[model samples]
Target: MARYNSWQNRSLIRAAEALTDAARWQDRGAFFGSIAATLNHLYWADALILARLMGNERPQDTITHSLTNPADWQDYRLLRRRRDRQIERWAADLKDAELSGTVVWYQAGGATRVTTSRALCAVQLFNHQTHHRGQVHAMLTAAGAKPDVTDLTSLG
Candidate 1:
């Protein structure tokens, strides 16, 4: 699981770096309007799930609040690197017992629900990231920007 998470994080970072060209950032049709926005959303979503898994209060609003404008390539790169580190750290420290317990939390829509097993929740979080990242990838390709290889093996 840690290896898979690491691969996914590396893949995400590579995709972000591939969009360093300013022209790619300006493409309006892209997800979150640019690679930066899409990456920010991924970070936000990961943080949300991590917080919940650690028994922290879930944010009342959507993870979209963490979104920031990536007008500068350097700033966007720095933020993405920071987020990647955070995810890697979180994945490494996760224990089997923690991943096996139930996680009860309020949904963004204000409904209460309980999730069984940390592994399942972690899988859901990763899956959600991949799903949205796919949307961003398609948008990036449509706007004529080349994305990094998305295969998990290529992450290494």
Candidate 2:
């Protein structure tokens, strides 16, 4: 899933790269308002989720800036590439025993929760990426900047 996610994200990044900053930021009425907003939200969410999965904390000082808007394209590209690499590496390291374990977490907007199955958390995490990536895919297509195929078969 991490390999797939990174492949899809690379496509989005490439498509986004073709746009001027203003074009990338133009409002097209998606949930996050623009391509930039959508991507930034994905990264922000990934940071939180990845931190939880890794049992480590992200540098807090960077959260506010990223959640508001991703770093400028060059910076964001670097940050996102790093993030995708981490996800891929971590996913590669998972063991079958770990998949059956429980994952407990807290989201800021609400209370604590537990997943009886770590596999469930993995499912949700990857599904979350696909969900938002679909939104951005539509937005990008409408804007005539659609990336190459994102289907897992194609990625594989």
Candidate 3:
């Protein structure tokens, strides 16, 4: 799933790169309002969720503020690519015993601490990426950018 996440992100980001800055950031009336914003949201969520899974410090940015930074397409792309590699490395190192272990972290505002199985947290990270990436795929297609196939089987 980490590989798939990275693969699809590469495709989507590459396709998004074909568009003008104005086009990529243009409001298309989607949930996040534009491809750029939606991708930013995904990057934010992935960073936070992956941090949780890896037992790292939770990001200081709240969900409401997730879309505020890395506004430049190049910066967002670089950070996202680096994040994908980090997630892949973490996934590769995970042992079967760790799957049953629990990860504890604070929710968005640090108000409540929640504990969950490492397995479920992993799924949440990947699933959340796919969900929002779909939104980006739709917006990209609407803007006439052709991302490569999203099929997991298509990953080489």
Candidate 4:
């Protein structure tokens, strides 16, 4: 799943590179507003969720502001690419016992939230990325950028 997540992300980012700054930043009426914003949201979610998976502290407030303008796109792309590698390594090292363990995270209001299964938490991370990446794919295609095929069967 991590492999797929990383592949899809790379594909989307590569396609987004084909777009001009204006097109990348244009509002598409999606939840995150634009392709860049959607990608930033995915990166933000991944960072927070992976930190929880590794029993680490949350990331800083860089993403607490606007998602589209979270950071320079090129810089964020590099960071996200590195993060994807980390997630892949983590997934490869994951054990069955850890999958059944519980994970806890905090919400925006300092509310405590618990996930009964760590595996479910991992699943949710990929699911979250897929959901938003689908939006990005649609938006990219609408703007005539060619994102790679999302089918897992042929991806390998």
lDDT values for all models: 0.65, 0.78, 0.85, 0.82
| Tens-digit lDDT string for candidate 4 (10-112) | 8998998998887888999998888888888888788878887777533333335348545577887888889899999999998888888787766654555
Clashes of 3: 0
Whole-model lDDT for model 4 versus the true structure? 0.82
CA shift of 21, model 3, Å? 0.8
lDDT of 3 by residue, 27-87 (tens): 9999989899899888888878877776764555443446657878889889989989998
The most accurate candidate by lDDT is: 3
The ten-residue window of minimal lDDT in model 4 covers 57-66
Q: What is the TM-score of each candidate against the true structure?
A: 0.71, 0.87, 0.91, 0.90
* Ranking of models by TM-score: 3, 4, 2, 1
Ranking 2 against 4 by TM-score, winner: 4
Q: Comparing 1 and 4 by lDDT, which wins?
A: 4
lDDT of 2 at 35: 87
**Candidate 1 lDDT score relative to the true structure:** 0.65
Cα RMSD for candidates in order: 3.6, 2.6, 2.0, 2.1
Q: What's the true lDDT of residue 138 in model 1?
A: 77
Top-scoring candidate (TM-score):
3
Compared with the true structure, the alpha-carbon lDDT of candidate 2 equals 0.78
